[model samples]
Target: MRTFLDSFFILCLCFTTARSLECTRCTDYSGEGCSQTTSACPANTNTCVFTYSELRIANQVVPLTTKTCGNDNECNQISRMTLAEDTSFLRSSTCCNSDNCTSPTPILPVLDTTPNGFSCPACYLINSTSCQSTGTIACRGDETRCIRMSINGGATFSLAFQGCSSANICSMQQYFNGLNSQLNYGVACCDPSSQGSNTCTV
Candidate 1:
């Protein structure tokens, strides 16, 4: 009877050892010993274990992907309105054939100086066509002129201050400055009784 009990105990030990061999170790994915509380099994014998430092180094070696302007309005914000070669006009739905589409905005010359001091709208210009001026035009004596595309979709003309010496002879010059910088688009016509020549006020 003692011999039978000893054999039974040996059989139970063998079963426990077989189960431990199936899972091995939980650390370094060590392939030895029974880890009762872990869900992980021993890693493949041929593969190296990934350390925390190794994971961090591998992460540093790669870049993560990101998104920009994923939606429609955001998409429109970065879109460029090609002028001249593509000659696009920023038209609101009220001015467009499609009632749902907003018009493309115009591309203007960027200036080193912004039009401040006076209550002027923000100017839009690309890096290549930025203006190189530093002076401001007063309402009467000083005048500043710059060429712009036509508002009527024809010629790239000059939109400048006519020097308010007198109110009668205040017609601003519209020129063809060989740069092909003309305003050939449409905007609301400023009433003659309003300020400026109302030439290219888009």
Candidate 2:
């Protein structure tokens, strides 16, 4: 009986060790290398994921990249959509499942700053009753609507982003999940009568 119990314990330990996966976690956008220590994934975590996004707000454009644990569904899922002249667009996600199987950082393409004449109310403020902006920006391409995205995940931690949006983003039908949070997005498209009105106040 003692021998059998010891064998059972050893088997369980071996199983757990076999399931452990190590993945690199890091974030960078300025063409810098993202190097970090490997982390042991939780037992339930399935895959390691890397994502890159380019966001254009007002006159400023920025990039965001991250590495995190993701599900099997996100594996090899590459999604990219430009919001009217690429105002703010989600780039892609590359997911791998093997231990320490993370790929290299993605290289971002060059920026296209050409104005597409799509304009909307653009403000990214927090806990404020109104959006404050001196002027509206030109929408690039296929982005003909004003959009507002509100994220509420943590208690008292809410963010608001109101800007130009493409039809692809405004009529988005799916809600995607990210590290520790599920993004619930809502969009209000600019009516034809509201275009170039400085504010989609309708």
Best by TM-score: 2
Clashes of 2: 4
lDDT of 1 by residue, 110-133 (tens): 311222222211232331222232
**On residues 1-202, what C-alpha lDDT tens digit does candidate 2 reach at each position?**
2221121111001012334677767665553445576677656668776766555546764555666655566544433333333345545567778877866555555544455565665665544323565556566544556666554433434445566655544543232322323333334556443553534631
What is candidate 2's CA lDDT for residue 37?
63
Stretches > 4 Å off in candidate 1: 1-117, 127-174, 177-202
